[model samples]
Target: MNHKYIAFETIVIKEIRRFARIWLQTLVPPAMMIGLYFVIFGNLVGRRIGEMGGYQYMEFIVPGLIMMSVIQNSYSNVVSSFFSHKFQHSIEELLVSPVPNYVILCGFVAGGMARGLGVGIIVTLMSLFFVDLAIQNLAITIAVVLLTSIVFSLAGFINALFANSFDDISIVPTFVLTPLIYLGGVFYSVELLPPFWKFVSGLNPIFYMVNTFRYGILGTSDVDIVWAFLILLLFITLLYICCIVLLRRGTGLRS
Candidate 1:
């Protein structure tokens, strides 16, 4: 095998093992949190609300919740792991190596995607306990989730590249990512919103992701799935370019 492929595989395996070893911290907490959401929001509040888009409220929110877990875990894995390597000055080993920039970027992005999808699967199984999830379109469900994971993974990579401190790595997810996911139609459909508010919600990119994934599972959506797929592709391309440029420049990786 080529050395570059070996290097890429090494980085990905190291990242996977790093998070797996800390499964209590990395995996179990998200599962517990989603369970609470299922109990409180899915059972208690959802009962009062009734159906959303012809499915029970719990069923409706399943996709969004799963997507939410994917977005958070994937982004967190890459940003925190990459930033730690940078902090420990261990990233210089890869920077000084002959591995191509794309390989290096993809290795980390793959790591992020792995964690994101891993948590997503766990949450999806947890959802099955709360609601009988009959996937409306299996292909779309997988495609949307995979694309969403890639977009956030790339976004996380860029965030890590620009992050100078640990706080910098976290500020975006807390302030920006959390708000967007909350407003992204996790609990309620945007069709219920007033015109002005609906127009505003249209601007949140995460909205498209949540709704599209919801459509995949429920066969109903507020936005066009094609448009959502296009937007996801655009973001992935742009973020990939941005991450590659930062890697080439050694943005936060360089002292």
Candidate 2:
């Protein structure tokens, strides 16, 4: 086997083991929180909302909730794990080693994707208990979820690189990611918003992701599918380049 492949595999396996060893901390909390969303928002509040985007309130929100779980898990996994490596000073060893920067980056991102998709599957199963799910476009559903995970994973890696402390790892998710997820049409359609708010929502990348995933499952979205794909791809490219550049420059790693 190639040495590069070995290095990549080692990093990925280490990351997977790190989370798997703490399944309760890494996995269970998200499932439980999403379950609360279903019970409170989907059952209690949905009864009154009637319908959204021409689907039952519960059904309409299921995809968004699942996507939300995926996004949160993916972003959190990388940011926390990579930052922990930095905090422990283990990352310095990898930086000085022959393992390619992109390999290290992909390994962390792939691990994050695994956890994100794993939680996504668990959330989807949980959602089935409340509402029947029928994939409107299987291809689109898979593509959107995978792409969204990659985008957030890369974003998390960037956050990890720049993170000065544990608190720094959290600021993005608390202040930035949470607000975006809520306003990202996870619960309501952008069409229902006034023209001004609708335009504002359009500027939110999460809006496009949530709607695109919703479209994959429900065949409806407030944003164009083409534009959403473009955004996901664009973010992945830019963020990946940024991660590599940071690695090569020894940002956060050297200091």
Local distance difference test, each candidate: 0.92, 0.95
Tens digit of lDDT per residue, candidate 1, span 116-204? Answer: 99999999999989989889999999998888888998898888888889999999999999999999999889999999999999999
Query: Model 2 segments beyond 4 Å from truth?
Result: none
Q: Could you give me the TM-score of model 1 versus the true structure? A: 0.98
- What is the clash count of model 1? 0
Query: CA lDDT of 78 in candidate 2?
Result: 98
Cα lDDT of model 2 by residue, 31-123, tens digit: 999999999999999999998889999998999999999999999999999999999988877988899889999999999999999999999
**Per-prediction TM-score to the true structure, in the order listed:** 0.98, 0.98
Could you tell me which 10 consecutive residues in candidate 2 have the lowest summed lDDT?
A: 246-255
How far residue 172's Cα lies from its native spot in candidate 1, in Å, is 0.3
